[model samples]
Target: MQQSLKTAGVLAFQRSLYATDAQFYSVLPHQQEKPVWVIRHGIRGTQNVNKATEKEFSNIQITDTAKLDPTAEKMKVVFDIKFFDLANSLFACAKGKKDKEKDTVKKFRATYDAFLTRAKDSHGLKEVVLRYVRNCTNGRWLWRNLTLASTATITVVKNDETEHGLSFDAVALSRKGFTDYTADELALAELFVANLQGYATDRFRVTALLDFGMPGVQVYPSQLYTSNKPKGFARPLYAVGAEEPVRTVEDVMHFQATRKMGQAALRDDKVANAIRTIDTWYPDYESIQRPIAIEPQGVSLELQERFRIKKASAFEIIQKIDELDPDSPNGMFMIASLIRGGVYSGE
Candidate 1:
């Protein structure tokens, strides 16, 4: 309990909410099934001031007294690990002029024709393939309104009951809104909503401490993205173009057609091949889960019984399930069933 809340300075009220060890481990995904939980446990710097004066605060500083000397003790914890949600922190890959400066994860090097491929076939494929992936990484926005219920507001980092510490991470403002804003112009909830809509962060692994009312309720993330994002989470795009296939891949080949604009009923197979390239979520901000009945877990289970065959790997079955149930509002059930089935798959 003492070690649970380690951040030096947290809010007074937040310092009182502590969870036990048992509660924190409940969410940890199995090692084989675990997704990447990039944990960053360091105090970051931010500027705050008096409400009336709007001046820099002398006492408000980050931990690490070596940096602030006498005032370091006055610094407060910003993000709470034990009580915060990690799902929302997974940012998309950015592809912007700024990002292009570094030739590394620079940008999606799709041919112009490939850009047109997306522009023609998928409704908002252009935005998804281009701008979304281009600037997936660096945007700080959330979806929230001030009038939302306190119940909707989340205390991301609460104070530690057994230790002298506070959390500086973040809280899940219920499912609709956020209690705080990392940016002055945006709330955490608003930031998340904007980000989700703007980019496709559909695949994610959440590592969090769901200290809802218990101690140490750990919820390891099997899938990075959660099953609870509302409809229209994908941001809307405003562009001028028609969607269809290029009958003649002759003039505009894969790389050539990506940016050219045209509309027709027959989609070119070249576009299909181009899609194969974009299928993987990596290298861009594309949604991994499709909206078709891919996996068919129920059918698979029945088949296992009838054929008397050992069940396939839970991951395999889940992928198949995702294929079978693409209609699953981002395939929520498919993901859950996979997590459960794999966790107990008699490894």
Candidate 2:
């Protein structure tokens, strides 16, 4: 799922769909055998926006030849966790007397007590991986393997009956690292960094919240780049000689081949090996997700299609995605993917 969504179109498609805890968790590979709670999902930002923005520029090595530092990425990202009482939600939706609500609460209390007792016998958690979708289209854009070293300020939100949830805000400084980006992705990164010269950002994108226990969330990242350009990014000599320049994948591939020949001539094995490993993801943007037999559970796909094409207002689409569906799969994802991938009909 992480590598699946890398295209801008796929991301736009993901922006259209919505899902519930049950539907989302059910789709997980290990859910049927061992179900884990999904706590929270959201975004965070660097405390010092200026420093973070500056680091982004330095990471890309876009400065003059004498000023370029190929490994200058360092920043911070903050996280705000919001928790809710699942038992209370279920009890509230239950149709019956007030006593039934009390009974449900008591049963949940007993179950939690037993669970804690069992959990105590297990070993402590060493690291926690907060999984999240950075952008729906570019599934590979993620902060998955994060190793945190920071303290959090926690606030509890309680209700008349029980302790509802807690909010935890933690700030962790970004680590220095190398990230591989495709040529197109690098172009986008260049565009964003160039645009950042005049812009300031205090916060990052927090598209949706996830409750994969402890309320895990995802946030946008900054200042990550690979040391070398992707394999096929070298422009061709013929294109360089031509009056009108063209930057095509074929040209890049040919340039790389020609350069590899030169490297072989000089016996520069290290540079040639690095060049051979140049990775790219241009084909991903053109991929299409085949329509699945998703059972609709929220707003009808027909109405969603209208909203997607601007036949309906943003408010309407928002309301539709926000609708609760505890039983069936929220077809918003299926419909959005199909439409954006050019595989679905409005009807």
TM-score of 1: 0.17
State how far residue 224 of model 1 sits from its true place (Å).
24
Candidate 1's residue-wise lDDT over 1-347, tens digit each?
11111111110111101112111112232321111111211243444434535564333221111111111111111122121212222123233343324432222222212322322333232222222111111111111111221212222211333232222232322212212333322332233223223332222111222223322222121112336644423211111235234456565545332221211111122111111221121111133221111132222221232211123322333323313332322233322222112222211
lDDT, candidate 1, at 137:
13
The numbered model that scores best in lDDT is 1
Model 2 TM-score is: 0.17
Model 1 residue 65 lDDT score: 11
Evaluated at residue 70, the lDDT of candidate 2 is 20
For model 1, state the Cα shift of residue 96 in Å: 33
